[model samples]
Target: MNKKQSGIIVTLVVLIVIAGYLATKVNGPLYVNDSDFNEKTAISLKEGKSSSTFFTEATLSRDQDNAKTLQNIKALIDDANTPKEQKATAADEYLAVATATQNESDIELALKAQGFDAALCSIVDDKVEIFVKSSKKELSKEELRGIQDVVMSKTKLEKIDVKIKE
Candidate 1:
């Protein structure tokens, strides 16, 4: 092949590789699954901790996802091409998301402080969901009530759901 044609081919190959890499990075898994939580809990227990600590692998993965989402919103808000009205809307959403993320962190800490092995909380559309990791794979009524009370007190949200996982 001619040198010019060879050069063009190389450039196209480079661009394709770059596009693929960017797509994978942006489209990566955004949330952890049940198995991830279970594996993290098992590892935590094997490490000799009586109770799992805050910020397990699953929790960290969640935090990373939240951070990326917030960052994207901020970028949209700052983009000059975005309409003023859209920017305003994005700003409001950013504030709400930031607040909810902070509340989730606080709730998780409160659950841990209350002697739970590990906990994760998420707020969506005014509803709160909590996932607590327990070695026993089950929680008593009182335990569930206590978690609900803590969540209510912390977030002041009427809709709260708690799940215990082993």
Candidate 2:
């Protein structure tokens, strides 16, 4: 790996160690809103679904999408007709998505360990999108920061957007 890649891996390892330390030292369940979510997932917010149920449903949808992508990647890899460069690109994408999936799982586990009722983390490019079920509609600055820190520690992303999963 190149210097930049090695540096990022080192930073991620340190952040993960820190996240494990921080995860044991927080409390509270709350949420905020992102305008982007309001625009995108407006339908899912209706009908007063239970927070845990909503999280389950949304996670299923996301997993389904990821599975489809993985299947396509597998097809590309298996097909002798496909170009090597295309297969290589698909393989890279597969690894990145798999890593992001693990990172999301870790972040959610950490948030729940921090006392969140339900936490859903999605990493898109360099941005992290978090959907959390809150006991209160508003989160204090400290609470918000705690959530962001957990996510940032698990992922290389610094741009985090949190939304209410009510």
| Least well predicted 10-residue stretch by lDDT in candidate 1 | 43-52
Cα deviation at 18, candidate 1, in Å, is 27
Off by over 4 Å in 2: 1-48
- Off-target runs (Cα >4 Å) in candidate 1 are 1-55
Steric collisions counted per model: 0, 0
Q: Per-residue lDDT for 3-118 in model 2, tens only?
A: 99999999999999988767755642222223434546544534478888889877886776676677777878879999999989989998998898889889999999988889
**How large is the C-alpha RMSD of every model relative to the true structure?**
10.0, 18.4
Give TM-scores for every candidate, taking all chains together and pairing residue i with residue i.
0.63, 0.69
Positional deviation of 150 in candidate 1, in angstroms? 1.8
Candidate 2 residue 101 Cα shift, in angstroms, is: 1.0
C-alpha local distance difference test of each model: 0.79, 0.81
Give RMSD (Å) of candidate 2 vs. truth. 18.4
Give the Cα error of residue 141 in candidate 1, in Å.
2.9
Cα TM-score of candidate 2:
0.69
lDDT of 1 by residue, 94-121 (tens): 9988988988999889888889878889
